[model samples]
Target: MAEIQTTTLIDDLTGKPLDAEKAHRIHFSVEGKTYRLDVDEKGADEFHAALDRFIEVSTKVAAGGASKRAAAAPRRASAGSGEQTKMREWAKANGYEVAERGRIPAAIQEAYAAAN
Candidate 1:
């Protein structure tokens, strides 16, 4: 059997971090509310699985945020119509929904016409 590492995250009612550890048990009190976490070997395994899921989700969120920030940065002029069509087709095939409107607010139609 593979050895599993466990991690815990304890928070108060206000969502403030109380404690964190890599042990199978945790005890803490917050705002007069006491809490105890005791996990057996099986429970520890499950807890580790949950922690893995959280790490995966957090990584994905951070990556998405970074991607959005990068995309928000200004780029060179828009691509030509042929390139745009190829991009739209690629997006559709990859299960991404492409907006009908162009990136430019005004002169979009004119720009697209000139590109083609």
Candidate 2:
């Protein structure tokens, strides 16, 4: 049987650290099981569309938001323009998954590496 894991992806939708008062729980299923996770509620409804888009694109790119942003910075500094576009394209072509903060989820990383 396949193992089941739950992960929470955090975003500063309001440009600030998340507070418990404004959080939404989103559930996703893996291997026929369901997992519930929380998201910032401040922009839960308003940013849902963009968040969804970001997740979809990130899944395909296999890069985390922070890593992508970090990776793009140097390029932008050197080129002085359009670093985001370049990074996105580079990630897509490389089959990377974008994570919310560039840091790999411990569970996911462990599972992938069989470290646990």
| Clash count, one per candidate | 0, 10
Give the winner by TM-score: 1
RMSD values, in order shown: 17.4, 25.6
Where in model 1 is the C-alpha error above 4 Å? 1-75, 104-116
Q: For candidate 2, what is the lDDT?
A: 0.49
Q: What is the lDDT of residue 71 in candidate 2?
A: 36
Predicted structure 1, TM vs. truth = 0.24
What lDDT is reached at residue 52 by model 1?
75
The lDDT per prediction is: 0.53, 0.49
Candidate 2 C-alpha lDDT tens digits along 1-116: 99998643555443444555566766644434666755676455765674677667654433233344333443212322354344444444556564434443344443433521
Tens digit per residue, CA lDDT, model 1, 2-115: 998865444322233334443356453433466676644455577567667756765343323433534466666877887677666655565656676565333443444454
